[model samples]
Target: MSYLFIILLAAVLVYIIFFRKKVVKAAEIAGVNYDELLDVHVPFYRFLELNEKNRFEKRVREFFREVRIEGVGTEVTDVDRVLIAASAVIPIFGFPEWKYKNLTNVILYPDTFDGEFQFEGGNRNILGMVGSGYMNGQMLLSRAALVRGFSSAAGKENTAIHEFVHLLDKSDGATDGVPANLQPPAFAAPWLHLMHVEMRRISAGKSDINPYALTNEAEFFAVAAEYFFEKPRQLQQKHPELYASLSSIFGQDPADGGGR
Candidate 1:
């Protein structure tokens, strides 16, 4: 064998031993059939060709390996794990080298809870959240909302995707929606202008984009990302400029079959 091939083989062997083994064990415990899970549950995977699907699968495995997932009040099944990993993978598939450095663990709850992880009267239906302050590098997800997010094809409210988008927004040390890591300095002004105009339109109920996006630029970006991935064609049709901006940041165009 060639030296390069030998070296690559060694690297793969090392990865399998040190990383892949742990993920395989986790999947076994969860009884996860990844191929079946992706085929049945993950809608975004439907758009990928075979080669891309393989890459996506690898990313999913790697995500599960790197991030620790624990159930708080529910048992995490293979489907639940797959859904969570898919949420993380779908958003960053366009950026091959990207990692959720700020994210290390995912805590799954049976349902939405308050910041202290307590369910109350008014704060009952939160879907998912990315952590900050003492809870940094963590994510909390509602199992029911998570299932519902991917179970339907009607709305752009995938809780997992929303929180992952927030993590991406937080990558540059802030989640102000500017995405300093992704946004070029020169493009910041135009991006802000676009956000303002869209927020106004949403406030006026003139746009079909989610009104929740009007909460702030940070939420606007996350909500827009959910639409970008879940309803790409509609987003591109109605808000081409915003879609283009998202395309620039994510480095892919879902409207164009995931940009090959």
Candidate 2:
């Protein structure tokens, strides 16, 4: 009986290994070509300029190679191209584990899509949303919103960054914005304390963080992520302690790219 069980386990392991390999191959076949991806989603020349300015071109290319873009509606535009580039590149500066051989499908929407929400009493309402990201999974975006967010990094909130942050937080299991994979042992006390403090401050309307963060721990993590990447200098300058906590967690420095 034991021998039979061992044989069955070995067969199951082999089957799982084969299945995973097949799935990865299929994903590779469906992946967009590098040149084509650059043309349709982000112009190669523009990326070159960004790379030159930031000295992160090779890293950016490596990151995009792992992502797969899927256009949903009409042909992808120049604006769509730029936004996708930003989505693929910026996150990696903070989350290096994202390179772990997976496909992130980029879904484009012509405009804001209707998102339905049901309340406790069974009342439903539709809300217009620009974009959302699933953990290490897919990203949905609206061309118009993407343009606006990229054009004015200071004013318009970036939904792509916001949603992707949620995914990062969900890496551990729950979407509470505290990804278990990235959490360092040394940061446990400071992270918890500062997060609680910031949450309370936001709740009291004393923080620059979006009011949305006060909604929950997950939203707090997501909203903080948007600010961390988009307004790194400002966040670090104004909230050094909070920035320190974030830096410790992500193991990257946005404010000058040095260890905090």
Candidate 3:
């Protein structure tokens, strides 16, 4: 029995090591040129610098290596690289466990992609989806939105970060915005309470955050995350309590660049 146990343990160790290496390799193949990434978005350096402060920086690099960008139209110029990097990093910032794991592919359109949906009445129609951050495993963004977000430096309404935040929220099997891993016993009450209060305020138009956050809890979380990174000062100034709760849940301080 003891020998059998040892064998099982060894097998588990081997699997972990092998799987992790494969992930790293995949990431390398998918990563874009560092210089190209910088040229497209000047803020990319700041983000990279921030990542350097945390032990997770190396892992973040590896993760990017594995991500592939496809279906981007001609509108995707060199400048769009920053959006790609921001989309890749911001979501993982709140969930470091995603390192070495592929979050699937990112499909970029020139701007907002036309989406078609079928109504219950059997009528099929297409609608223009225009937004900075739209996520469903596949993240869609407008090139103009990406530029505005980076140039602003306020970080209050980053579409890439916002959409990816949704991806993180849905990682645990649901899009409810409450990431399961973040729902520790200690945080349960505070997260729920703050979310409820802030969401209500936004709905009432009493908050500076986008009113779309009032759509649901999941959206509340994603929109809050966008403000947390893009517009930290504004979010803190307007919603101190909500900012504090987010700081705790994400395990890092955007105000301080803890995880960058």
Candidate 4:
């Protein structure tokens, strides 16, 4: 390669090595309170064995170290930090090497935002949103909904996970609901067919999933991912094929008590 290219590559390698050391040190400092917060807010944390818990904690530490979480119109507490990190950690915990490289910032608002992304005005019930175009690599979450999403034991609504899933769905260049690169080649036809079937069921009001999933395929994927993690057993029972597809996509089975 050219001398300039070699120099740039060396610089990148140095940065990666140094950054990892910093991340580990940061994790050491922040991970001590991981269990404490998980005990209070994360129901999924209770099911994991010691090893899994350790792994989850490591991932959480890494996530917090890598991403920047800031609050708007409110103070961002440790509970908020833990919950936000947990939301990100849960979805990709199966893959140890996986990191949300696309997500650089998480902005939490005091409550629901409006169309203009302000705290008040039209309709005012936007829970979470992943940035696109010029605002890419950013996420916005409602503090109230973020807490409620983890506090609730039943519903399959998680603002953090929902937005993170959208982030994952967007990794392949478009958020069309199909994470084409992540799915297996054989999964292509079956996945599309399942989406159609599920949409039909939802339209007929025979499905228990949120009707908002019907908005589009991208939304369907995000909402389905929320259910896949929150109420895995129920989702599996109601939509076995969808569950299986998600299991394959995520490389983990939450229905099996969150095992990879």
Compare the candidates by lDDT and give the number of the best one: 1
The reply for model 1, stretches above 4 Å from the true place, is: 1-31, 120-122, 258-260
The positional error of residue 92 in candidate 3, measured at the CA in angstroms, is 2.3
Tens digits of lDDT, candidate 2, 125-244? 211122334433655666666665555444525677666565566556667656677776665666767788998888788888888787877777777876776666788987888777
The per-prediction tally of clashing pairs is 0, 1, 7, 0
TM-score of each: 0.86, 0.65, 0.68, 0.86
Residues 1-260 of candidate 3: C-alpha lDDT, one tens digit per residue: 69999999999999999788677546444545555555345443464454442433444455455654544553444346445655566556556556424255555554444443222234423111222234433555555565666675544667666666666666666678677766676776668788888777777778888887888888789888877876666667778888888887676566654222
RMSD per candidate (Å) reads 8.4, 8.0, 9.1, 5.8
**Candidate numbers sorted by TM-score from highest down:** 1, 4, 3, 2
C-alpha lDDT of candidate 4 relative to the true structure: 0.85
Put down candidate 1 lDDT per residue, 1-260, tens digits, no spaces: 89999999999999878676576547544556677789899878977889999999989988987788888979988888889999999989988988888888898998888767765457676678888789888899999888988877548678789999999888888889988888688988899999999999998889988888988999999999989988888889889999999999888789988621
Residue 101 of model 1 has an lDDT of 85
Off by over 4 Å in 3: 1-60, 75-79, 94-97, 100-102, 117-137, 153-155, 257-260
Question: What lDDT score goes with residue 126 in model 3?
Answer: 18
TM-score of 3: 0.68
